[model samples]
Target chain A: MRSVRYTPPLWRQWNLVWNFAQRDLKSKFKGSALGWAWSLIVPLATLGIYTVVFSFIFRAEPPDLGNGRDGVFVLFLFAGLTAWTFLASSINGGISGLIGTGALLKKIYFPPYAPVLGAVVAVGVQSLIELGLFLSVLLVLGNVGWSWLLVPVWAAVFTTFTVSLAVIFAVLNVTMRDLAHLVTIALQLLFYATPIIYPLTLVPEHWHSVPLRVLIEWTPFSQFIQVFRGLTYGLDAGSWMSWLTMVAWAALALGIAALVVRRRGGDLGEEL
Target chain B: MSEPAIRVEDLSKVFRLHTERRSSLKEIVVRGRSRRAGSFQALEGVSFEVPRGTTVGLIGHNGSGKSTLLKILAGVYRPTSGGVVVDGRVSALLELGAGFHGELTGRENIYLNGSILGMSRREIESSIQEIIAFAGIGEFIDSPVKVYSSGMYVRLGFAIAVTLDPEILIVDEIIAVGDEEFQRKCFDHLFRLRNQGTTIVLVTHSMGLAAELCDTAVWLDHGHVRAIGPAPEVISEYLGAVNENEALSNDEPGMIRAGLDAVRSGSGEVQVRAVEALDQLGRPLPVVLTNEPLTLRVHFDVKVPVRDVTIGIGFIHENGTGIGGSNTREHGVPIQLEPGVGYIDYTTDRLDLMPANWRMSTAVRSHGHVYDMLEKAFPLPVRSSGGSTEGGAVRIHGRWGAAVQEDSPSTAPSAATP
Candidate 1:
């Protein structure tokens, strides 16, 4: 006699996603004594190691900032690390998102994409915290300029790219559990393949160097990192072609991932 | 009449059983052929309808497809065949606190669980205090759920579930959690919900609770509907079949019972030859009417000579709750047995048992050791003249009369008259 076909509104579903994202953020460092400070330890140590190795051991000169000032290698590395972590952590968390929320999905019914989106949000927040620290250092060094206004725009572009990849991996991982592990290894390889630890110039300077140069310049990960460094370093910025490449990649990833989710989301509980 | 709240056609579910774990790509590439694993029919052609505003119960043993059916109704698992049409929103408490995180505080978990159940944040905020009050764990709602005891965990989960007030509620054995008082409180809430026109489907092993609460009952045995009808009638039929199964399993060599071959178990030293149920006038009967005096006559024979013999008689409810028993040892009636045929008769003044099926256990022992025992010897059906009062297994006969009280202050001064 009563209708059972009511669908919840999109805003309500988004609120639910927000609640889960909050849980993911709070529970990550729930028991650690140092709390969220623990997250800074690894990146800071990596920055220190890279600065030492490149500046002292390799005797490499730091790059120049926009106003003809020499950029500190650690600051440059920290900028690249923040963008890379945002991209990598979001993908990693998204790949394992459904499996991580297996207990919840098995019992209750909700929008299937909430867990994947929530995981991305958690990592995104953490990346933002790291970005805050990075920006403070840039201000103290007086290296910031008008180009810094594009930081949020860069973050938006990177989030769109990262979340789409995460959703694709997460849905695929449900059917092929090895995909989660395969993705970890693949992302690790992509990290080095893209120019995170080194500048793009590390690749051969020849114009006819098609394969390596294409991977370094045309891939979405490389484009995202280039834009991030452009906003922070305020020089050596990529052309509008790089921004166009990143947006197109994000749209492509989202379209493919959305199709996969529609095909497989309902049956994910059985797979789990 | 209103349309049925749940209409289920020939619903069935099949589960694929993988013979080997082919989760890896290399193994599939190397050794996979058709990839056809075996299949198990967890449910087969289960068809039933639950009318609006009525409580229907599913009663069955373990692995009898009760949980699978409930999951299907709750839309957790898709049916392999047929279909179910539900007219209202369905909520299930399949496993308590399944979505709760151990590290989250109870306050946070409440919102999370509410959102998971499809409630808006505003609705949860409005009903948060009521949920806490129902859970009754003062000051513990602020602590992380990991620190709560098992009882407290289920209490909070149940509290949240019932407060949501879905149109159709399907619960699978969740009431077995928590203490007796909490169980009673949960049942009371369910009863209140039923009164408000909520259609409820309960899957439980407690036949008495089914008989008490449900308007209809479906008995599932081995993924098939064994019987479906009125609650008490179907439960009686199920209990009778269960008793027959126990009788077959308890049958040993050289021990026999009469009137009804129900249950018998023990060595055959002194075999229990037969057991008969009789009315007050001593006429042998297969069934006895409630409130009529009934007698159980146990006939025995001595396969080997036994010295100190004691005879005992007991009544067991169909659900295996022991009612009462009497033994010759407790009565101090010692008998010297040499061998030969003998019978012991245990009579009751009034069979106050409610109208239901029951089992009678008879035994012949020496001192405290059993020489021969007959378990569930007779399948006794106590028929009531009318419907029962629904108190419990037994009915108590007591007089009830009331008189108007005189409003006189001096009446309290007279102890004898008062």
Candidate 2:
């Protein structure tokens, strides 16, 4: 006998995913006076604090814009913070997506990935707004280039990477309640490790026996930040090595996420 | 013939009862795989088939696996063993507004909930007007659903679900919402859908509703299939078992006569031997028809001689509300009792009860000295003899009339006043 399972094609289910995303976007800023401004205000505030501590207090120098123009420390910091904030928020939001909808899951059956993907898209929209404002600022500064056209490419890559990790963590968080806290702490440490606040040159070439600079350069988050910075702020194409690392990381994470969701997604109703 | 809409083969579901609710990484690491307290078999080897274009009811008490079985069919819960094949699109209203976001407006929730039920944007847009009209919450459609009254919330949820025109619909006790008028509207819509050949699976505690709406019924007890057949037969058997269980649990002389199908509680001095609804010809009536003459015959055994005895019989609606009752004392009639078996007959020319299931409660008392009381002593399945559109518990035979009189100058009151 044929089994009673209805799994519509992923493309057909896009409307459901969009609906979930719309819910996330609207409810996120539902009752605030500032509304969508808070999305920008939050990262901007973080930018302000880091600019004070690192650029002014610690006297850190930023890299040049590569277009015969001097680099402003705040603009340099905002470019990297844009990428970092999107990754952090999307992953964090994705982790709670399944748990928050546990009540709905217990009563109805839909694709479990819809809510998590919706959350990622919601954060992606906020990140897009931040990117638009940052690009406009760069345009005003006359830092535009052909490399700037590659921003969307890097964005698609960045989103894939972010969604993969989000799906993974979100599914894990359903069974392990403490995983969210652990992820929060890990993201905090990752923020400082990615050189978003300080320049990449601040890291020492070597620390005793370890190649500290090379290790940080090869990290997925560091490479993603470098590629985003190159396409927009630097006006230069990222190196092939960085592009390869980003793709490889995204592909690996996507594979694992697909496997995890397939194995555990069907039984989530009982778990919730 | 076409294939059955739903077919279940030896379905079962077992839930692991977590002793400590250990759902954390730390607890799992410390306690390992042996942390399972025990396993509860929620359903076991239950099987049934519902033909296409027919409605089936799952009837059982709480924790009898009815909800679990419905959830399994709805795809919310998977069976631990066996398989079920359901044809066509399925929409499950397991809980009204289950997908609604509190902060989203009613209009927005329609799109969200509709899509969750597998409706396209065009489908939702096309039926949106009908859904809003059915819900009857006009201006509130634009307001956030959190501000809606609970009745409005349920109405909107039900409206969206039914308007989608799903080929197979699964509902669990959601029709018991809203006021009487709204409930009537919902039933009208459901009947319309059923007429259009939509396969429906309903889980309800209302045996009256089950008898009215379902063509077949599956009675489950403690995760096992007790009976499955025509709706009324299965329902009667289920109710009989329920009353029998109630009779067993209560501590009274009722326990001595344990096989009685009704709940008996009182002193053993006098026992109710049997209670039957009879027709005018003195034959046992299987079911009482509304607006027809009927008689209730109560057989009693007077083991000890008693005086000034009053025998009473009351009719109660299936929903547990007492309709109307009368007794010998109220009618100024006293029975002279002795040690012997006797019977009493309560007859009426017309039974004014509406078309629904009613229960009879019989008792024998004397000056507050209770002899015996039988709760839900007899099942009075009152059915309509024809297509009657009347509503409410009792059918009132009233008439409406209109008359017009010719204008007359001499007979006018104004001429007399002048």
Deviating ranges (above 4 Å) for candidate 2: B253-322, B327-418
lDDT of 2 by residue, B1-418 (tens): 8899899999999998877787787877887844678999999999889999999999999999999999899888889999899888888888878889999999999999998888999999999999999888999999999999999999999889878778888888765587888777777777788899999999988777788888899999999999999988888788767655654654541112223477788886888877666788887565566778888778889888888989998889988999998898998987987888988888988999887778878888989988899877666667654434456899777888875444766554454465
lDDT of 2 at A164: 91
| Candidate 1 structure lDDT | 0.78
Q: Candidate 2 DockQ category?
A: medium
DockQ of 2: 0.63
Worst 10 residues of 2 chain B by lDDT: B250-259
Off by over 4 Å in 1: A1-10, A59-62, A205-210, A235-238, B1-4, B7-10, B44-51, B85-87, B218-310, B314-323, B327-336, B340-393, B398-418
After the best TM-score superposition of candidate 2, give how far the Cα of residue B158 lies from its true spot, in angstroms.
Answer: 1.3
DockQ scores of the candidates: 0.45, 0.63
Candidate 1 residue lDDT tens string, B1-418 = 8789999889899988888767665666688743657888989999998998899999888899998888787766777898888888888778777778788899899988887787788989999999999888999999989999999998899888877878898887665577788888888888899899899999977776787889999999989999998998988787767655544664341133444545556666787776676777786654466777877777878777777788888778877777878888888888777668888777887887776677777788775677777777666666653334365788766787876456666654555584
Give the clashing pairs for model 2.
Answer: none
TM-score of chain A of each: 0.91, 0.96
